[model samples]
Target chain A: MPRFILTFTLLVVLSAGGCSPSNEQDKLTVVVAASAQFAFRDIAEEFSKNNNVAVDIITGSSGKLTTQILYGAPYDILVSANMHYVEVLENSEKTHGEPFVYGCGVPIVWTMNAEFDLDSIASYFCLPDVERIAIADPKNAPYGEVAVKYLKSLGIYEKVKGKLVFGESISQVNEYVLNKTVDVGITAKSIVASPKLKGKGFYRELGEDFYIDQGMALINTKTTHDLKTKFKAFVQSEEGVNILESYGYKLSK
Target chain B: MIDLSPIWLSLKLALLTSCLLLIIGLPIAYALSQWKSRLKVVVESFVSLPIILPPTVIGFYLLIMFSPENAFGKMLGDAGIQIPFTFTGILLASFIYSFPFMVQPIQKGIESVPDHYKNISYTLGKSKFETFMRIILPNIKRSVITGFVLTFAHTMGEFGVILMIGGNIPGETKVASLAIYSDIEALNYSAAHTYSIILLGISVVIIIALNMLNAKKRR
Candidate 1:
């Protein structure tokens, strides 16, 4: 049938064209969650320095990126904030192989007040002077969902409910804390670990067992590229773990 | 379950904001209409600033401005009056965001009236405020409605500034737009769909009404 021939020809053409590249082997596209942006940028930079491939990284909330992928966005790999999004792609047979757990994200109560330093997160909540708290919007941000769980587990979500504000992402929450627009906010440890924001605030890791597991998937597509596979392996390698740890991600066993 | 709370919150905000803008915008627009100076262009441009800038750009600065670290925010904080994450913050942000929508139409409305009508009223000994109430405002009723509708609709769809400055607390800062966004993020497409329909209905109704008024004016 023409339909079968059309599908076959399209697949062959797609495989023949490696990401609309200027050259066949030089282009790779990876979609990274907003939370993993800095780490992935560094990883991609290092990878391109050694390999001939030029990597392009697209970053946004994992859910939004997942929606884009489902709509046939030409990403070679997706690094999501949690496993749920990766599993969605896997269930649809859109992933080339099994997704791997790379890191565990830690949530923290961060503050910009110079004098209000504490080693624990609980006290930051009860400070009478601290009226406005910040967290990522819980619906799309895994860190926000984890933040909500951590607050509830601590038995303080209700009491602190009135004072809470929501950011669009972990990065915005970092801005709220660093600008002191909020008294304290729950944010990803990775944000504070970023070199630009490091030492700009006081943070106490929630260290609650409710960490969001980070996942990466090699998307199934007609494009011929091994760079995403290499980047994935590099992300799980010892050097990758070291780089992630420096950016405040807990190593996954 | 169908939650009407966010929709209700959005209406209440739009209602309150439009009312405030109507009360506050008239005098400001009036002053701008009659007053002319070398700095008038600067003032007019300042009023038009929100329309040109991206909402997030304004939202980001407003978030910082409302922070207690700044002088303005510090004063508010010292007064036990917090602006960030509050309805007041949303109202303030909405007022600034929707200011042009309110002012421009009214300014144009006031300008549309022929100067002879006001002069005729003045010749009969009508005061400035009296002339405005009797002569200018009567002719500009359509423009006033345009202002209110545009401001109301603009506030109803406000997302960026509210998301930046608001804490998204339920029944406080979480308006319908924010609710719909969070619903999409939660993968609750059905709820988001419902909210979008209602919002779409509102926008359709508003545009229809405005067109009707505009049509009447043309006649």
Candidate 2:
């Protein structure tokens, strides 16, 4: 059995070498959204243990990664913060199959130094004491867009406009709060759960109305059929859902 | 194709930051050149700290220092003057980030002025301040101009520091570099390309003009 397994591995390696000059290594590369780094890293390590494939995870903002995919960045899979990019890629024929809703994201009002009082937050908007409030850039980041929506719904977008600070990503928004650059920050709940912000800060859920539906898709043109199917199945499995849940994300029912 | 806001903001920031850096940097540079104290080494090292450290490190420290909860920030908050996420914040970060560009060139200029000229000025009954203003400054006019142009260009290209502090607000703190980053990140490549080309063009023009000014000064 050991000799047979070694022969099979050698045959697979030789076949991969003959298949393509560029992709001679036959590794499965997955591009994930930067905010999902911690969760994906853990998942990828576990997945790599049982599979013949080596996973390379490239993390960045979903919009930026989408643009990179459009510009022909070679990746087998893309996990994004919003489903819009997956739909865009599907329409553009970039994905092998339909995008799947893997998890959902929740926005949280996070503070580094103190527990945020939601009841007094509305009054704090007009207060002279609260100088800066950090949010992700709404244009490219989903969490920032949700934060903006919540602020607009509360009718204080314009009142607190001057005191707003925009971070490039959810991680950056956490950095702004962690460093005390902003009095309070609205970021992804995943960021608030990270070890960096664990004891230093606290977060309050922004509710389902402001939730962002995070999704994933396999890039059809660049990926192998077997690897793509494996990745898709892995993410939809019970293990993936548990991992997502552990990261402060809700699994899509 | 012409979104003049970033261009205008970049130029305005470059001009304002260079001017302020000159006011603050020149005296420090001059003092460093004249003095021979152990503290001078420490102070000079501090002045060049921004140049050596990564811009993000400087930006992060500035973010904490200027935020409303910090001591300096609390004082400024009491005065109705918020620094982080404002145009003033961008200016301050730009000044610190680009300090060495102004000071180093001017320091070299000052150091290159012969001690004989200073002795001659003193012999003619001129005070130290008057001698520096008249004799030393004029001889190093080219260096000062070079410093100003270099500092201005450096400020125009600032990204990490400004992004950390400026809040990326349009027509306020959003300079061209940050705008290009935003455009690229949003998949608006056409806008990003346009902004990048314009930025490159402006930088080239400024560098060429500075060169011409230097050539003319030399002649």
RMSD values for the candidates in order, in angstroms, are 20.4, 20.6
Compute the lDDT of residue B185 as modeled in candidate 2. 40
Weakest 10 consecutive residues, lDDT, candidate 1 chain B? Answer: B180-189
> How do the residues B172-219 of candidate 1 rate in per-residue lDDT, one tens digit apiece?
677899888765543356899999999999999999999998999999
Query: Model 2 over residues B8-62: C-alpha lDDT tens digits?
Result: 6777788778777877887988988998898988888887888889888987788
Interface RMSD of 2: 25.1
Candidate 1 falls in which docking quality class? Answer: incorrect
For each candidate, the DockQ is 0.01, 0.01
lDDT of 1 at B55: 93
| Winning candidate number (lDDT) | 1
- At residue B156, candidate 1 shows an lDDT of 95
Model 2's DockQ score: 0.01
